[model samples]
Target: MPRASLWFIRTGLLALAAGFTLGALLLLNKGLPIYPGLWRLLPAHIELLLVGWTLNLALGVAYWILPRFIRGAPRGPGWPVWAAYGLLNVGVILACVEPWVASGPWLASVGRALEALAAGFFAVHAWPRVKPHGV
Candidate 1:
């Protein structure tokens, strides 16, 4: 596996752990009412699990499994994928905190835009590699 893939997978696992922890807390709160504030974590939990975990894992696998060029860098330029990784994580964090901050709506919008940009970056990196076999 590529180093970038490893990083992406590891980050996704961390997000999964955090998301599951939050989910457990939410579930517990439902039965025991430990703290009503736990409810606010719902958005964060969803974002972490869906975008953070799922998207990261998917991207990591896609990056690893995508076809490579016969010459030069096997994966093409690494910066865009790295940028995707960074932007994605930051976006997920911003989106997750959308419900907790005073500037939530704006932050969430920015986060979503960043996430979209990350996807565009990843697409740029991946597009060339996605060709017929033995091209």
Candidate 2:
């Protein structure tokens, strides 16, 4: 597997952990009323688990398993992958913390924008790899 794939998988795992932790805290808050504003984190939890964990892991696996170019290369140039990685991680971080920060709305907007751009880059990088089998 490529180093980029490994990084994506590992970071996805981290996102899973964070999502679970946040979920647990939310559940505890429901029963114990410990955290007054816990509901505000619901969006972050969903984003972490779905986008950060699931989507990221899927992308990583796709990057690893997808067919290569005619030259037997695993994928295209590395810069876009790296950019995706950076944008995804940074976006998720910013988005996750947005709920608690004073500049939350701004952060969330920027984060979402970054994530969208990252997805575009990922699609662009991976699209060429999709091909009919036994070509």
- Candidate with top lDDT is 1
lDDT of each residue in 1-135, candidate 2, tens digit only:
999999999999999999999899989999989868889888889889988999789888988888877665557787788888899888888888887889998999999999988998888888888986443
**Tens digit of lDDT per residue, candidate 1, span 20-109?**
999999999999998898899999999999999999999999999999888899889999999999999999999999989999989988
Error of 1 at 16 (Å): 0.2
Whole-model lDDT values for every prediction = 0.95, 0.87
TM-score between candidate 2 and the true structure: 0.91
Candidate with best TM-score: 1
Off by over 4 Å in 1: none
In candidate 2, stretches whose alpha carbon ends up further than 4 angstroms from where it belongs are: 133-135
Question: Candidate 2's error at 48, in angstroms?
Answer: 0.9
Instruction: Report lDDT (Cα) of residue 84, candidate 1.
Output: 98
lDDT of 2 at 60: 88
Number of backbone-clashing residue pairs for each candidate, in the order shown? 0, 0
lDDT value for model 2: 0.87
